[model samples]
Target: MENEKTGEVLRVASDEERDQAIIDAGFIPGWIGEGGLRPEPLHDFEPDTWNWETGRALLEAAATSINPRVAERRNIRMANSAAEKRTSLNTIHCSYQMVAPGEFARAHRHTINAGRFILESKGAFTTLEGKKVFMEPNDIILTPNWLWHGLGNENLEAPAFWIDFLDDPLVAALKTIFFEVRDEDYKEMPIKEGSHHHIRWRDLDLQLEDLVPDPNGRYGKRLQLQTPSIPTMRLYIERFDKHMTVNPVKSTANHLFICAEGSGTTKVEDKTFNWQRGDVIAVPSWKLFNHRASINATLLEITDQPVIEALGWYRETTV
Candidate 1:
């Protein structure tokens, strides 16, 4: 065992008896073992994809078994395939949530910052900060940390679905998680017109009509969403032309992409993940990846790049 650790070590402490005494004193020999400090950032998440149809089917099935009134929220978390991480990434997390027709989840607030990308909606609304803001397909609605919000669907004909992204993992890791549920059912809220939290799809689509791909052929007609309130995360939309393949890039930030429309394949390292509308792909930190569209496509990219950059740990290499 002594010869097993053959790195540069100093002769400060000694003997088996002394080591045992140190252990008994509630301390380990610092000279032993390569510890938690790594040469670079390490993560359990890997390049993985989640099919929308599968998630929708599961959620649709859960509607009959998992009651929102009892379950509180009907969501399927996108746990990572690598290391069974039980999270989409180390710092970011995602879940596919559904609110059945005429069902509403009670109002709740938490210290974890969160937002959602609407996948299917009609007469679906979120009572955000005590006011109603209706959701539409492809819309992005933000619910920052500690902001009171509740979800519901007024449409009796169909259910509503959305992908919820959060900084819960980071919050939990920091041991600062705080949560509370409202007293009464979230109902009869006043309507909020042109709420700052709602980013309508109509506006974003109009902007993308004349947008151009990046000069370096990395990103498509990309749009960086203004989200100064959530300092831990950033949002973006990258549109790609039919059959267009973007250059591969590796970065220190975790990346999660939701296919807003069309079909495409994302190559992460040696693995290729094919995605279509409503599909999601998770590319863990420091993974080399790129996207190629089989048809004109739009992707919603969510990343913790803001926190990474803020900590002066941002790095990227494009090839």
Candidate 2:
């Protein structure tokens, strides 16, 4: 056992006691462990919304002053206070990052796969593995594991911001994390000759209209937009019509839901949360939850289901 507040590891007398400690901490033990899954445990995270408007205000304040460590070579600016932590699950990390006009983040490579959901931006581009991809609102960009990547904002008057999602926690937990900073002398690297500029292109209006809900759907209707680039994570959009409701359901993997459009109410266990455009909510694993949309709602769903399923540990049960 470890004391989170004091950062001290607690020693237990026996392996059984250690297993019990982990169970008390709200997690199922690994396959090789003595402690197994509990049919029902208290959900670790409740449904809640993080307002983007509040986040943007914090971003503006952070822009007034910069941290020397982060601004030394990479002149990029970010709203540290606006970053969201995955309190529900430990596998994924999410944050709202901003880059000011004429600023650039220095190139770096790491073993963790990362992706960004473009929020609002113009004249911004991300270079990954020697290919430059221009970014726009609602677009998604991915940087494969261990690929060299960097971002720059060329817009003269406007700043670019996006929601970043990464599997850094999972990589760290497995003790397979690796990182390398690019040489300062080689800052302006050239793009690869045959690399494609964009990995994914989406039209939200057309996608919403085309994604019809099934009469016997389990969780309303969702359309997956992520390709098979990152094996450990999954991204998709769940669409709900006005007054529609998704019945309670539980899953083996935890979820991070971002309200892309419209308004809705999400109920997890006994708690309920209201959401609007650009709001984010974290849902823990095996939490019985339901949703009701006052108007048509589009929620960007990020999860680690793919990784759990690949390892034959994925489970789902409708309540």
Candidate 3:
């Protein structure tokens, strides 16, 4: 007989000997042994580190990964996250949203605030409320908490890619986080052009001749084109002539300004920062500021004031 331990010829063991060997190995015997021995618990655990480069690679992989049949059935083409799993508390969920030409992601909204940055495709715009802002590669769109919005691909041959960021912790903490599919699937309104009913990039470049300045000493023309009741607020691009100035806005939330064309300087508090096209600047909460654009300049400004007002936290002062 071959020995099981050494693979050498040996005599076969009897049942009694086998039982003896098991006892010698310090293991409980089956059926009639003393109470089973307990093993040590593995209590100490460590989590993996989060890396930016790894996150980028993982996102890219997910963007190109094939969708499983089950996912396809549910319209889940690609679902991935910065965390290892969707349930992980320490990770950020990043899903790759790819809409084929002429497809839509359906209108939806959640308690979590989200922002989407375009990675590819043209002729697609996100309609927030009634405003349809055309998207370009690297264009960042903000989807504030509880705002109804949708994305539509107008191009016939290009796929659109976007990176979505959400307030994951807040959603998970409140347990009120959810996404809803609207009955209409998409907003029923047509895309408005040239600031007729919506604010467009081109319309922002025109002069502010129609804006009548306030008699109350407010600097920039205080025309109430879009009000907080409208759900979203937007401002067009135009240069502030050499001496023309804007009064500081003292508000609870911050303001986001994107330089779409030309160069300029923004005075925030006592600091002045120069800005140019593609530059995004955030005016911190409760700060006093004004901007001066060089030559022929244009800017796109989006702020959280309207959203804050809806929540009853908006405050402002004029200087």
TM-score ranking of the models: 1, 2, 3
**TM-score winner, 1 or 2:** 1
Candidate 3 C-alpha lDDT tens digits along 1-319:
2335545432335766666666777965684544545342111111111222333455446544534222331112122223334421221223345665665555667766656545565888776765566776655566666777767778977767654534453367658687664533345566644433233333333336565544554444432333233343433334444445556666655555555456777776776777765444546456667777565455455454554577787777654
Flag regions of model 3 displaced more than 4 Å. 1-107, 111-122, 127-149, 154-177, 181-197, 201-207, 212-218, 221-223, 227-239, 242-253, 306-319
User: How much is the lDDT of residue 179 in candidate 1?
Assistant: 94
lDDT of 1 by residue, 60-92 (tens): 998989988788899999999886588898899
TM-score of each: 0.90, 0.77, 0.44
Best by TM-score: 1
In model 1, state the lDDT of residue 171.
95
lDDT of 2: 0.71
Q: What's the TM for model 2?
A: 0.77
Q: Which candidate is the best by lDDT?
A: 1
Q: After superposition, how far is residue 122 of candidate 1 from its true place, in Å?
A: 1.4
- Which residue runs of candidate 1 sit more than 4 Å off their true CA positions? 1-38, 184-187
